[model samples]
Target: MKNIKLYQVFLALLGLIAILLTISLFIPEEGIRVFGMNLKFPTIGRLMHPKKQETAEIDNIIVDVDTTFADPLLQHQNGSNGDMGAPNAGELSVKNSTIIHLNDAGLVNLHNFFEKLSSAATAKKKVHILHYGDSQIEGDRMTGFIRERLQNQFGGNGPGLVPANNVYNTFAFVQTYSPNFKRYTCFGGDKLNSRKYGVMGSAARFTREYKDSAEIANETSIKTGWIELAASGSAFGRSRSFSTVKMYYNSCIKPCAINVYENGALIHQDSLKADGKSHIFKLTFPGTPGKLKFEFSTAISPTISNFTLEGDYGVQMSNIGMRGSSGTIFGSMDRGVVAEAMNDLGVELIIMQYGGNSVPFFKDSASVRNYASYFKGQLNSLKSMRPSAAIVVIGPSDMSRMVDGIYETYPFLPYCVEQMKKVSMEAGAGYWDLYGAMGGKNSMPAWVNKGLAGNDYIHFSNGGARVAAQLFYDALIAEYVKWSGKGE
Candidate 1:
């Protein structure tokens, strides 16, 4: 009886194992779903939605008219005879046409801004455009493209912003370093404060301390005629400490003293000092337009904050990227300092690209609205400071969320975009529908599948970024044309 019982138990156990294997085989690779409605697995259910197309229509009016105006004639063919041969005649006519169009209007407006920027360049006027964004610009990809395009169109030169040392490894065009000094950026929490300067606005303290050698050198060559030093904070000391630092320029020559060069010609030279305060230094070199360079070495290691160089009249794109920033820290920065910087740079446009970092934590419409309110306050503060700069707020892109055992659009993304748009308009800033531009709801799957966007979906790939930048630029151009009466 015992042997029989043992045999039956073994058979039961084997049968149970076979049943479990069968169930496993039937499960979906992503995961088993009760009704194919729960998207909880990555890369699955990405096809659940169809592509969305965002379109807008606007009417353009044109008119036709004929008119005549008087003109002074210097002389007539029959003056000596009796009648002058047909007194000098002048005529005027106007033509108008009505047209309807569909496009990313915002991008068209941006293109108009660039057109004006190009005109400024042609006239040899200094044009400054501030491109403030998040990590998308941290690598300088989008900004670089716009800068190159503008410069090529308008005759400007050089990379715009050069920090004392590059803290991020993502910068592809330029490299930076400071001897005998370790650098900490706001990106890593190694340094955090209310005065954190980022792609959006200026910061307060760019703290630095000298170790051992006590001297720092920034090695990037300036390819423009002007260099603007940007810094802030009263915490480093009052006036005396801030006023006592010296800047130099080093070449193959012996003078090695502080010298400013324009187009390879010497312009000015000065001596060194060791005061411990922060201030902006403006260096202008004279000659035919060309590249310039500034070398800094002080008795004490000075904290060099921000550097911008450009033509007299071309767009100046400045990126203040704070990694991990939720875009909620703008109100914390010293507004006075930031305003001053904006004014000095002649900043005409400001772009705020954020929201990705906050997407994961978004829960409901109320929470999103609260965040938008905070963003509005930040914009309001900026407007109060630099009342002249045009502001454009870029909403976050689509982020993936698991649903029905597969990845899909985050449930609240559309709500978030709507909230941001409302806040932006309320703050008197123009809002760019990045979400809409990306083709609306659950569009990331299509973008990634088409290889236009990255797999992450939240952030764009290089090609994706270029497309986004172009869209924004085009929108701006369209608006500018309408404002300037350049479009028929």
Candidate 2:
């Protein structure tokens, strides 16, 4: 009886739909009025065919962002170089996205930093800007674009700082090494016991770690290690043209003679000081040397802090990509060594990209606030190390995780962003809302579907990174314009 009733009810619904279709077909375009308002019905032709609703594209979904920044492509075409190319970093038109919040002191610091950039060439000192981030920036994805644009526009050259035995295979520069080289990092599982990881927060060694002077004196044979370097085939023009090479090391007990060879023949030779303090050795080539090889002969290897390729003046921006960090490790490092390294490099700006690594462990709003507070402490520590440097903290980009069988934005992420910005402002640092700029909550799904982000929905693709970086660049240029009273 129940089955019969369900079938009858289904038939009645079908009959009702048919009746409505026939009535709609018979009804005129101006239907019979039932009240003061006129009624309308679909015509036979209209009833037969219906229009479809179109889905909006990625740009269409971007809401509440200031889209006034000149289209990067079109802006590049207006370059004064006569030939069509992109303008320099500071040459963009109109304000970009709005900064979440920055206190008055932070604005003053930014202005001071801009002064440094503008007068760096006149002063004959290069402004070193350290971009610290997680794996998203590893291998020079987003930072590469920023570096290229800044170097071309501002006065920087060379890929900022390439590790001696690079762990990440970055295309901006190429380096190959002998098998004996070992690496240790403060951020990794195989960290140094001394906790003396310098400004780069990592070190590379060609031989065993130095323990005592006796070990170096009793050495039987000189340890030989080598690294061959060549600019990659697709390297950016600015990154490839470097005239200076600076080697940083510390805790040396044995004098190491380093030979710089071009192809088969040695072009230069220098010896490392057997001192127990940090030191930087600089060598300037007559021109951009070709296919250089650095051969080391040392009985006791010092910690190889960093190897930097740079020009004579302007800016030097280094990407310090730590794989899994919450932006809270600065206080744990040897403060004197880090400060000396920054001073040596003339660091004036520190752009810290973090909060992504901390988002996964955020169980609630309190956790988010706590992490932000902890991050503020690290920022304070960094400021102490580089007292004159201005800091900018870029909050995490949109990240999604599988939640209840559907990929969705992680909960408390906005809270995390809120707390981060609050603390950064309190710490007198500028904060960029990467999450908001990329589109807010659940935007990762759209970015992933549009090929702007990877399948993991946590990282941006190369194309997306370019967009992200451009947004940031525009923000900086816009504020800089406001500060300088130019670029109207």
Candidate 3:
């Protein structure tokens, strides 16, 4: 009986708690009300309500300038002896407003080249401009734009730069697909100790050895030009295999013979050279408009270093990029082989864009100076190999990092730029301040925020890359104009 009474008391308390909870749900807490219901506070409404609404006024007006001079004395006071403020300095001198023009140092020689090139073009001689740089020039962004402009002003046909193996194809507007051989690049570790074909060029050594009676079919058709075959020591031991080489135009016809169609008449059948030494082969026809097919079969496997099919006078630009290269790897390559290859290609200009990789590793100015000295020596060696080529040095662009939760320029950026400039001057090369052109220190924030540059603040976005390429091109063109006495 006692246990039953305890249980009943507990049940009574639970029922009372449930009733309290139900009442709490409906009651509003200070100024809170149920959804879609209005709370009327009669006491506050009568005290706060206004008797009438007030209105504000706005005025609009128009005014015109008076032609008649009212203050002759004031005008006389402002006049400066009829000098017109020293002739208004005549449009700020094209030199001051534009950053595109060459500095005083690079004007003389560059101008002479332009003049000679112009003269050669007028004479219908194929004048060539070789633009070589780092990864920036790889896909022909800068080179293509400059080529189009120059070719429009000058005269040229078709795109330059032969389709080479191991190309960054995605970035290229032109495409190349080859078979019978695999492609490798220095960027990959296939060749450990390779030769940098001199400033004029570099030799790319292949791991694939040539076989006797090896036939390689390049599936590309020549649409606009003739091809040339050249060899270098890069293919050191493979030269003896290729004694007889045959080129077939249209594989549908077997045992292809060289047909001479001069003036729409079959003049003669010239025997094509089966003996392959690195020499030029001019396949002449009746100038008929048709796609050219070439089939190369050799009795002996000929070792080829470089082959170029050139059409018209134009510039061929190539970019070789190594993410962390310090511009010191040239000495590690096969100098003789590289020199031979570069000479055959006729490389004229070399642009070295580096310095970012060296920043974090270098400590002080003395250390930088030592690196610069070493770099200068390397440049001297390159010059020795390719004596005729002109070299240009581009400094690193502005790079930034976070400081106390805010973005800021890298502490060592200025130092890096300064060291690079010193090295360039010592090496007898022209230097362009990429940082300055990028609006100098603290400019990275603006660039990244405005989407002009990448979030890394180092590499450029596509638009940024285009703008950067344009800047460099403009500078070159400006230098050309100033030197050639050609005004825009």
For candidate 2, the per-residue lDDT at 377 reads 95
Among all candidates shown, the one with the greatest TM-score: 2
What lDDT score is found at residue 234 in candidate 3? 26
Question: Candidate 2, which ten residues in sequence have the lowest lDDT sum?
Answer: 76-85
**Better-scoring candidate (lDDT), 2 or 3:** 2
Can you tell me which runs of candidate 2 are displaced by over 4 Å? Answer: 1-57, 60-90, 212-217
The parts of candidate 3 lying over 4 Å away from their true place are 1-107, 170-173, 176-188, 192-309, 314-324, 334-346, 403-405
Clashing pairs in 2: 76-86
- Decreasing lDDT order of the candidates: 2, 1, 3
Poorest lDDT segment (10 consecutive residues) of candidate 3: 58-67
Q: What's the alpha carbon RMSD for model 2?
A: 11.9
For model 1, state the Cα shift of residue 380 in Å: 1.2
Rank by TM-score (best first) = 2, 1, 3
Which candidate number would show the highest lDDT if scored against the true structure? 2
lDDT of 1 by residue, 170-272 (tens): 4322333324444444444444233434333332122243233323333222211123232222111110011111221111111122455544576556633
TM-score of each prediction: 0.63, 0.81, 0.57
Q: Compared with the true structure, what per-residue lDDT tens digits does model 2 show for residues 1-488?
A: 43568889899999999888887878877577787876776666665765332222457534433323332322222212222222245454555765535799898888889998777655666889999998888877778777776665666667788776688868678888888878888776667666667888888777766556586578857788887876665666667667788888887777788898887798888898887688987877655657888888887677778788877777788888899977788876889999999998899989999999989888888888889889999889989999899999999988888732467778889999989899898888999998888778877878887787999989988777877887887788778777778864
